[model samples]
Target: MIVVVGITVGILDVCELGSHFILMSITIACGMLSEAYARGPPAPNASTHHSERQIPFAACDIAQLLIALCWGITGDIAEIVSRARIAQLWAATGVAVAYMSIARWLGNVIIFDRKKSRFVANAVYGLAFVPYATSWCALIARFALAINGAEASVPDWIIAIVIGMFFGFTGTFPIIHALSINRVIDVDAAEVAYAIAGVANKSLLGWYMWYGVNRMQTA
Candidate 1:
């Protein structure tokens, strides 16, 4: 339902940068939900070791990765059709996909491996935010150019970069609660944390972009 509503909102204003970000974010939220459900049915026999029951979880992770790639491509399509090529949008999308794939692999390693390194796991996860931040920065820069013409100056770029970092931090930081794997912490708690981060990254970020665009247009 959230995905449907988000996509609908974007469709209503397909040309808007805010709409594109909103759509991409919402799809990401859905992908997060897919990741949360990676665990499958219990083994039918008690003799079946947990290590042997890897197929279902692996499949679900793949599904989540595919979901991310699809939505990333959707945003790329929007940029290609509706907006100027200010950011080399496809390259950003490709980078995002690549980073996310690596992050997913690291996540699995952290989850299943006995020698999991939390620092490496966290680093990859944090790095995944870069593409989104760059895209947001590009959108803001494009907006400034639209409003200020050739007069869009250094301060404008600085402000956009700052705003992009703010969004990136707010979106990615909370997911650390999930990424920092601990045997003592409840798995459900981690899922809840992830869901919260999804809301911050997707819905709240989208709202801020929409509000900023409206303010800029009116000013």
Candidate 2:
């Protein structure tokens, strides 16, 4: 399944190795996050709670950063034009990914009762995606401008709005956690859903952004 998805995505004009490798990494990361949460922290307590969350979150973040670093270092911009500009874009994305990752773990630690509170938990966690979404929107704009040598596409704004909403949706994992905490959803089901969302956000959306950029760059 991973290979199939990777090959499909790699069909786009880009660095095939980097694209395939990153897609595979994201798939594995999604599974790791789901499994880790499903197992429910090695020891759940106030003192160790933050640590448990940080480990898996950090692993996923590292995987994302690795791909960004690979593209930046290797000049692997999908279209191969303006290597310097694309490198800057990847650098910015790396920073945003790091910010988003930090916000995830820290938000959970700072916002107590994240799994218990109905509204506050979901709201707080959802805000963490702000950086991630914003970066991508900007990336799209700048990338389009670079490729077209003109104003960014008007449709880019629509894509930006959709990306924002999508990230907002992704951050609602606290709801899933709450469901598991209250036993409203069985642990297995919650984990499976969580894994699906993780894959969608990290792997699917990431590919969408890259593919979009590739199309613009090549067109």
Candidate 2: which pairs clash?
none
TM-score of each: 0.35, 0.29
Specify the highest-TM-score model's number: 1
List, residue by residue over 129-177, the lDDT tens digit for candidate 2: 5556555544544553455454434563444334333533453433655
TM-score for candidate 1, please give it: 0.35
**Worst lDDT window (10 residues) for model 2?**
71-80
Clashing pairs in 1: none
Model 1 ranges off by over 4 Å: 1-39, 44-70, 73-120, 123-125, 128-150, 172-219
RMSD of each candidate relative to the true structure: 16.4, 16.3
Alpha-carbon lDDT of model 1 = 0.40
lDDT of 2 at 46: 53
User: What overall lDDT, based on C-alpha atoms, would model 2 receive against the true structure?
Assistant: 0.40
